[model samples]
Target: MKRSLSLPGIAYGGDYNPEQWPEEVWAEDVRLMREAGVTLVSVGIFSWALLEPSEGVYDFSRMDRILDLLHANGIAADLATPTAAPPAWFFRAHPEALPVDRDGRTLSYGSRQTFCPSSPAYREAALRIARELARRYADHPAVVMWHVHNEYGCHNAECHCDTSAEAFRAWLRDRYTTLDALNEAWGTTFWSQRYHDWDEILPPRATGAVPNPTHRLDWRRFCSDALLALYTAERDVLREAAPLTPATTNFMVMHNFDALDYWRWAPELDIVSNDHYLRSTDPESEIDLALSADLVRSLAGGPWLLMEHSTGAVNWQPVNRAKRPGELRRNALAHVARGADGIAYFQWRAARAGAEQWHSAMLPHAGTDSQIWRDVVRLGADLKALSQVRGSAGTAEVAVVWDWNARWALELPSQPSEEVRYLDTVRSWYEPLWRSGVAVDFVRPDADLSAYRLVLAPALYLVDDAGAANLTGFAERGGTLVVGFHSGMVDENCHVRLGGYPGAFRAALGVRTDELFPLLPGETLGLTGEVPAGASATLWSERLRFEGAEVIAAYADGPLTGVPAVTRHGWGAGTAWYLATQPDAVTLAALLDRIRTEAGVEPVLDGIPEGVETARRRGQDADYLFLIDHGGRGAELRVPSGATELLTGERIEDGVLTLPPGEVAVVRHPR
Candidate 1:
């Protein structure tokens, strides 16, 4: 009884909210589902109010009919625990369960995810509902997977209420048994914030000034763990009731979500799934999608599912821009190309009323006659044609270190420059690699880098002892490593590493910087030597005394003009390069190009037109080369001798395939 037994090739369909519609519409839902080739539907995700009208009174009658209809129509179910949204009755009884904001305002129950993660009443009631749900339908034939608690920590990542304070104390006690250890770790002597008693410490509510960085850091960690505890409690109940079915919670791994350290959370789940939507503000949101997909695939170490996306516009942004025609197909295929086994949207049908009423879905409000609906049907067929690539894995020869701990430390209230955004710096390095057609995988700093030929650490401002050693060892063991500005400045405690800049990696990089001279607003500087022509720098520069390293580039005109802006060192059998300042796009791309050649890393395909996205996922029998013309350029590439393009059924014997602008091709060749 394997969990994969029920998967219909690449599982299709999205969140099916039968609870939102009447019974009569459910019949139409099933008919349309079959017509669209849907194989699965996530049921009852936010149905606690419908299922549990009153305390100790359970109703499974409605859910029974929904599951029956779905099963009768040959659609599998990703059954949910319904713990994300606690019933209004439960909140009315235990009003203290509502989360309190940092400004001491109690969040009302009108919005979703109103319950505090640390509330005992919430934990008990959520577990009970999960237990009851499992008892009723765990053995049902339609239940293929158990989805426990939707999007944990999406809204209330932290709470400052009394119950949370108590739980925080308990968590801290477990982390640091004594008051002295807690004081030492948090560095409380700076502003007379040392704790003599464990209960004396409280959540950093709104104060006159910024709170301790270490305190904020630890609280972030505790918040992630608190929600994780809720997920595990429900997951255990579902696991006991249904031993064969796997359980997962959709992760928000896109640019905006940084609350949860997914590395700590990914190992606890049976599958790694993520919900990603287009950041409509960015013109090239597809690159953001690629970054998120690669991160999820790396977390799973193989294939994963695209839990939720949008067919068109999302309702949340200030100006929700709709996806243009053909953008939908390209987005879905890009996820699959990066290693998504299945593609799904936020919901199956558009909501006529609700907070997210305007969010797009599989079946738009305009019905099947619309372009969105047609694209959905076409994408479903294309996924079925890609059934052979379900377990296939991406071939990422390069790795980039992306850690939440460092990110949290970097974004603290006080820093060199407020403009040195964390995600922006990471993306600056990743974009060039994507443009070059190379596959990239995001990794934790201490993860085994032996597999990759090149590793990039952009704006990795924080590093602990183990992480520092792992990075330095990779460079010493013949793996080329690149570190960006402001990295290795502090230890895990947010305490500066004392003597020089980049304390943790100074020895490995063979460069020493006494201080940092971050640029002012609207400032820019030029660089010369071993870099692309007209290479400019911005945001940051440092007093680099690169005595032991070779100066690859130097500031041509700035405050620290003529200083070593970029340096390289041959440490042991490998190489370590450091960029003292953030270089412009062309310079960074040229730098990566030189590094790739030196490290012997190759892109998925070479000599392709610019703006075309490329990725190769290798199955046991064949390698699928995904060529997506995201750049809107007609292009040609040399294909394998007898490769066949899956999308159009075109055979290639002359070893060349030409693609028109906005076209997509999946070329299959021997693995």
Candidate 2:
């Protein structure tokens, strides 16, 4: 709601590190930016070492020139604090500031994010630099937004050093307040892990065997808070200098990183931005893109920004596959369709040297002759064409419950099965909903479910008392809730529920799970009952004992053969469906189809089918329908007769628009 960047349309730009290039190329950079319609560029993100060559010695000449150049060219800036990578000189002055691995090995300062989150020396230096930057650029006309510390906790989320251990103790003391309370919450009675004094407690570092689940879970919470504390500290400094400017840090809500809980961090930010790249392993990364964008959008509760993504292959992955022709525009527009207000890539110009030289950029190393550069220029025009689409909002009828705290507990040391991943399980349900052409929004379990007709709770290993009540209450109301396997198994403290599995939902579900029946990898079992024929499941199964529930399906050959594998229970005015198995894609799609019909929750668009994604955005002038084709062939979409396709400026008098593979159509229907 509080976007500081007042642009003509959706922002189109990328991170610009002019320090990487010589001064001679600076003129051409802005010239090409103008040619490509670059509106905003993130500056000084990884320039800490160069900007502060010595301790407290400021060298603002380079950055000053960079800002001047961008301002002169009429481009806005999202100035950064450059705290992500502390200088080597600072590290040398405080070697202990370097992060320590879980095994107690001190990591060197060669890479970015090498400083420990809890180190006083690192914190002081970072804040000092931020203060200096804010004081200098507070009134700079080029500066539109303050980007606090690039992507917090990407590399060093957890630090096992002595300083971090002390900080962890302090954090725990603040949370638990008393040793007895801490002991009870942590269940320290088992394995003699109790703490009589706060000083005795330390982070869950490497041990002889599996560490305490509660200990690990709390440590994850502490690490996220520590990193967030770093962001808030810098943000306060910027706020003091530039009080009106909005501040935000880019979040990696994608699959790779899951350290910081954006649900906790979202409130602290004035704007929400996320960096996502298409994973090579996932051939259907397009659906994953929708999933990630939807989560970020819901966190923002409105439009967000795509801070960084690859124009081509990312250097970090094992096999960095390049984005096929037209894929770049497809990816960018997909984010826009999912409530992204702007689009930006990782870097403006490709790095000539360093760790991320191979990472794709707007201007590759091959210069303007490449297809990537051509596409970049075209995307800018395409964004400019849909200027009216900015500030549009997306609404969803279905919500997928996401709790980062639960994610931490689900992935802790010991569990039913390693394959029962938190994000994977959530996506198992989300993918089907996406393919079904249903628009989904992500929310915490305790968040208000009144807006949604259907809510999916998946992989919620740890649920607090409040969340448990909230889910039960939602089901008791008119909202149809789907409880997945491995959810509601434990409380917030990682303690297993006493009465039965999924203890949090037994009463509302009208059934109880006695035990878990985890299947081996590559193993699957069939189901018999109301589900589609050949409906089977993989990876997980559970023992169900019904109190008063209708069986939707029964396990045919698993450990709980002839027992109910899926159950539906009706409470007051709503319904709760419990799927005790990780159903195959076909089974989940079929099952969700039934649930959608019963709940009266349908896809966003009627004729939209699988392999093509569609989402509607409401604007003051009209309702915009985004049609993205990910299939192998062509597809046709019918819209209002008076609608106009914004991308191609084609007036749709016939109410039919043809979309080929890897293409996109944005049809604006007059209100």
Local distance difference test, each candidate: 0.90, 0.90
Please provide, for model 1 over 298-377, each residue's C-alpha lDDT reduced to its tens digit, 9 standing for 90 to 100: 99888888889999999999899999768999999999999998888889999999999999999999998999989889
In model 1, which residue pairs have backbone atoms overlapping below 3 Å? Answer: none
Model 1's TM-score against the true structure:
0.99
Each model's TM-score, in the order given?
Answer: 0.99, 0.99
For 362-385, candidate 2 gives per-residue lDDT tens digits of 999999999999999999999999
- Give the Å shift of residue 119 in candidate 2: 0.7
